[model samples]
Target: MDYIIKNEKLKLIYEPGKGAWTYHLRIPNSEHIEGKWGEIKVSGSIDDYKLESRNLALTKEGDKILSINNEIRTAINKKGGEGSNFNAYSQCSINCNFSLSVAIL
Candidate 1:
């Protein structure tokens, strides 16, 4: 199955299967990435997703994070299949400086 998460500043579509969840993030452009549409991953749940891409390495630590609606998050040294930290448009470098809008009325 698939899931979707959105807020006043971002939209996330979770695609399941393959032992991992791929999150498609849509947000406004930020200092690090051109926040149009980017893909992130989580080992098990969407609640703890990470935006990791060699094209736009958010950090060297790899354990980058993203905060969604101040609700969900990823964690540092995320081991196994759970965490509290995540990455988005800009991987996971700059502070949260992004926005999103509702597509449907």
Candidate 2:
């Protein structure tokens, strides 16, 4: 999924998993904050979910912030099957540990 900043015309790419979701945010060129890309993990029951991620790191052009070595385990509930009222907790990490929770929906 892609999200538009609406105010800055920025496009964000998001990857979704079972009871979790990750995203790669594109930074604007104007802000000195520098552009960054990271992932997030969300877990919990279908009705409720918990999310967490690493911090964002500064990156330059063609620079990779998140890497396979930076992945981290997130706390979640164990339940939910393929298609049932069940709730299962799962674990997932991004390329790097530099990430933060954007939102939960």
Candidate 3:
């Protein structure tokens, strides 16, 4: 099922069944920002090696916020290994309000 949260100025539709993908981002008097392959895509390097998201977990905060936590593993081997391979966790918080805010931790 799709999850939804909205406020005075914004609305968000999230598809938890599809890896918690963002289905639609709506703003008043503006065109909607749609997502085809999920809205949040996180990519970075671990020990100078490329790393990518492997899994995700979602949590809802009240009626206007959604929290998505990403777990990353499967290190991509590259030159210059810093130390040892490890797992990484990232949290993305989406808030819908008059003053909207998005935070990645």
Candidate 4:
């Protein structure tokens, strides 16, 4: 599922499961900015490590800002299962060593 943050002039869709990406952005009465999106990148020693977002919560929502938080983890292993395709499942197999909080204004 996608989380939406919006105000009178703009709208944003945050997709934590896909690399903590802001997958959609638009201004009112206008088309979404084609080919443009946002993402958060975390890197370290392991070049092939994958980052996943967990414990996503909307900590704040106000006229001036929107705050979202996630416990970030790198998937060391994964087990394919028959269930919802949320990335939190991948995070369940690892320990969270990073935290990310995003505030949009």
Question: For every model in order, what is the number of clashing pairs?
Answer: 10, 14, 0, 0
**Lowest lDDT 10-mer window, candidate 1?**
96-105
Best by lDDT: 1
lDDT of candidate 4 over 1-105, digit per residue (tens)? 122221222223455554433332212221211211122222221113333432222212311211122321123222211111121111222332232222211
* Candidate 3 per-residue lDDT over residues 12-96, each given as its tens digit: 3444564434332222321121222233222333334444642222223212222222321133322221122322332223321
What TM-score does prediction 2 earn?
0.23
User: Where does model 1 exceed 4 Å of error?
Assistant: 1-7, 18-21, 31-105
TM-score of each: 0.21, 0.23, 0.21, 0.16
> Which run of 10 residues does model 2 get worst, by summed lDDT?
79-88
Residue ranges of candidate 3 with Cα displaced over 4 Å: 1-37, 52-57, 61-105
lDDT of each: 0.30, 0.27, 0.28, 0.24
The TM-score obtained by model 3 is 0.21
Q: What value of lDDT does candidate 2 attain over all alpha carbons?
A: 0.27
Off by over 4 Å in 2: 1-6, 14-22, 34-54, 62-105
Give lDDT tens digits, candidate 2, residues 1-105: 122112232223344551222433333331332334433332323224322333333444633222111122122222211111112122224422122222211
Give the clashing residue pairs of candidate 4, or none. Answer: none
For TM-score, candidate 2 versus 3, the one ahead is: 2
Model 1 over residues 18-84: C-alpha lDDT tens digits? 1222433332332343222233322222334333341221323332323232123333323233323
